[model samples]
Target: MLDFTNASKLKKIEVNYQYDKFSWDHPGSSAQLIRDGKPKDAGMVEAPLNEIDQVIQNAFNQKVMPGAVVSVTRKGITVKEQAYGYAYRYLDDQFTEADQPILMKQDTIFDIASISKIFTTIAAMQLYEKGKFQLDDPVAKYIPEFAENGKENVTIRQLMTHTSGFEQGIELYKMRASREERLKAVLKHSLANPPGSKYTYSDLNMITLGVLVERMTGQRLDEYVKQYITDPLGMKDTMYNPDIYLQPRIAATEYQPWTGRGIVWGQVHDENAWALDGVAGHAGVFSTAHDLTILGQMFLNDGKYGKALILKPSTVKLMEQNMNQAFPGNDHGLGFDLNQGWYMDGLTDVNTIGHTGYTGTSLVISPKNKAIVILLTNRVHPTRNTESINQTRRLVARQAADAIPVAIPGNKNAWFAGYGDQKNAILQAKVNIQKPSVLSFLTWYRMEEGSDIGNVEISLDGTTWNELGFFTGASDQWQEQSYQIPEGTKFIRFRYTTDSTVNERGWYVLQPQIKTDQKNIAPEFTSTDWELRNR
Candidate 1:
């Protein structure tokens, strides 16, 4: 094993980045800690916990890494914290022994892989408050070698935004053994595309960032983070290079024949991070579900956790604000990935932000809904080819979201598009009507882009279906839609359709009204599948 004691011997470089405390830039000091008490009424009744439990149990039955830990929080209340299946069923190449699996528990520690980047980003932002660095500074200014191979213009912001034009990463394991050689190769590597011209997620961006932090402060990445972050947050179980005594409590991940390591556990799983003696930027941090709940709550509380102040409210705002708008759907902030639908699922909304790890871990925080959900699993255990656990991620996120009621009680009844792989759930009402009638309702929806859709149609003679309009976008603020009821219309139908793929956030229609002969009449909206919801 490479000596980790030589961290101080790493080359010292000039720091180019600098931060200024401009009046407009100050998001002000962090907000007060908001402690979670008993579950407060947020209008939501019950979380769809049965669905989530079923998903995890199904994963266990399917042999998807044997076990997992899922935690869900909504409106400052801990909704769910449960463990499933086995933590370790086997240590060999295959899970051969069926009865030897280690039982999973709620408090098992997990290697959070790429999710560690969020911690690094948080640490960097803390230093920024101390006037350590400006975001736009050139990488070459701090590390002179980064100027090589047409990379002099790469800025700190680009690295965080994932527009640094770097490829995924260099296989340092296949290259020479020295850390400096691998780092130099990384800095000097040619760009696959022009900087800021595109967004390509890469490990090199955060790796170089780890290097920059070291260069600026002469502190090891883990040490700096521990002192400024985890310790303050009281995340006792979150750290790098966890003690030998904690190994039994840690989830096992991967059986790596490629690295000649059998049953990789306790240590960092990312090869590049392992090359750096388990202290790299892209991955390395390990955490428990309970500790992550504290972290997520801190973010929701605007960077304050209990008595410890980690970041300013303004800094957290800046981190959640989109910086990769030019890349459209790839919404991102300084360090957090924003609006990712793959794992975030129903949790993704206007202010949704979080990160995912390669070892079947996910974190989603929705500021708009006052929610946070974490799913940690050792999906790579016993083998790396195990199928993805994305469905489980989506299922848990959706369950948490369902806890937040979308019902509007005052309306008595608003059309509720029950969330599922709905093919075409139509709501139709038969009513006595004349020429020049008006069909109106308050409508809001978050339909799946280009896949799921909602359509409004009218049947004049109650035989032929005529398309009135279709809704295919999202809105944080509700919208009002009105359709002119075709003359001599006897029936109206609100058709909400969905694919067998991802489900929509489901539509909400309030105040279904009809106007006939100068009379605005409240008519019963008939439904075959859609249900009336009272918020």
Candidate 2:
């Protein structure tokens, strides 16, 4: 039998490398301005990024969406930009068009749908920075009519965070005929819950925000976004509605007959946004993948892009801070979703933030790693009843995350705790001790907050163990940790538990040592699903 705890007679543990070299730059915090560069120039691995092409091809093969455009940027470099499949493939819900469908191009424009909310948010923040209004100020203060329907107490922050009492939405396309009447219906809509009492996602919040922006700036939402956002950033291809001449480059969307629209193409797919002249706060922005990467890079750069200061850095920080702490699992910043792993996948951390559009669009920004990942598709083309593209979203995000390697210490392999939802992995070792000692190790982790957990435990009897320390969220870099070993301790272990939900990049451990006043001890560990490999 091998001595589980021996100081000098034990063999040295060996490790293996899976890559050329491990990078130590991630989950990093350096923000670089967006520019064009190759994947290797950004310290990203090309093999994993190459896998992204096949994922998109598989989605196209399965008809998950008629087409898709993807963009990935790291360290301010545009590493990957590609397009796949058809931009317009169907004539109606049940039949393909008889004509040669337009092929997807790198510059193809997409109906970004709910991603428009971020634009509205940026426009509102501009006014707020100009001292036009405060976040805590009630919407009624600017748009006085919004005070109707028991919403007098709903503040601008409540609306941005979706904690206001407003209902999800009203049937503007069905209940109203004109834009003015639809606006009235929204202003007078009733509450579904009390203000600040719960977090309920509702388009009424963004709709109200759109009206507020217009009321404050005396310009329509489209004009304000164009002048303050798209124009300043040189996003010529991004807009609320494309002109007739630009229809050739736009993607087709749902075929709607209820609103007297047939084979909806080159226009906003959202019926409510269409009723509102394709400029509502909740939906109706259109842009190509390259244009959105610029917008995302601006946010990652903290409100500045290539000499244009679109928003104050302070305001950007405020927007990045999670405002919906009262509600767990639904973390929301001012207007962006924070650390949502459903779509963010391994890219998710406490500070990783992004949003998804109903039209098969998702954008993830990792400020820590200074990276941006954008995936756009028109799954609603021809119909809205197609299969969900959520799995593809998570897969692409994970691949982008894998492209950024985690630097291993001394360029050696470390023990990796496997990753998956509902995981319960443990690495335990027996210790022989009669007096006090110290246990120390180096570790790095990025786990789903409040769901995945890593714990260090010690036991005297083996049947019962006491937690020495536990960690959640992320350790932006590798850290050295030490704990005093209790007298009579016989075993020590690292137990990582995760709930049945989002799984992130898991825990890594290396150089575990037990020390006494007189000598050093090496441990022989038994692990469940843990392996030694350089990631």
Residue 356, model 1, lDDT: 92
Cα deviation at 63, candidate 1, in Å, is 3.2
Name the regions of candidate 1 deviating beyond 4 angstroms: 1-43, 407-411, 449-451, 461-463, 477-480, 499-504, 518-528
* Backbone clashes, candidate 2: 2
Query: Per-residue lDDT for 234-307 in model 1, tens only?
Result: 88999999998998888988888787777888898888888888988899999999889889888887777666
Worst 10 residues of 2 by lDDT: 15-24
> What is the C-alpha local distance difference test score of each model?
0.78, 0.84
Which lDDT tens digits does candidate 2 get at residues 353-392? 8989998999999887778899999888878887779888
Give me the candidate number with maximum TM-score.
1
Q: What does the lDDT come to for candidate 2?
A: 0.84
| Model 2 vs. true fold: TM | 0.84
**TM-score of predicted model 1?**
0.89
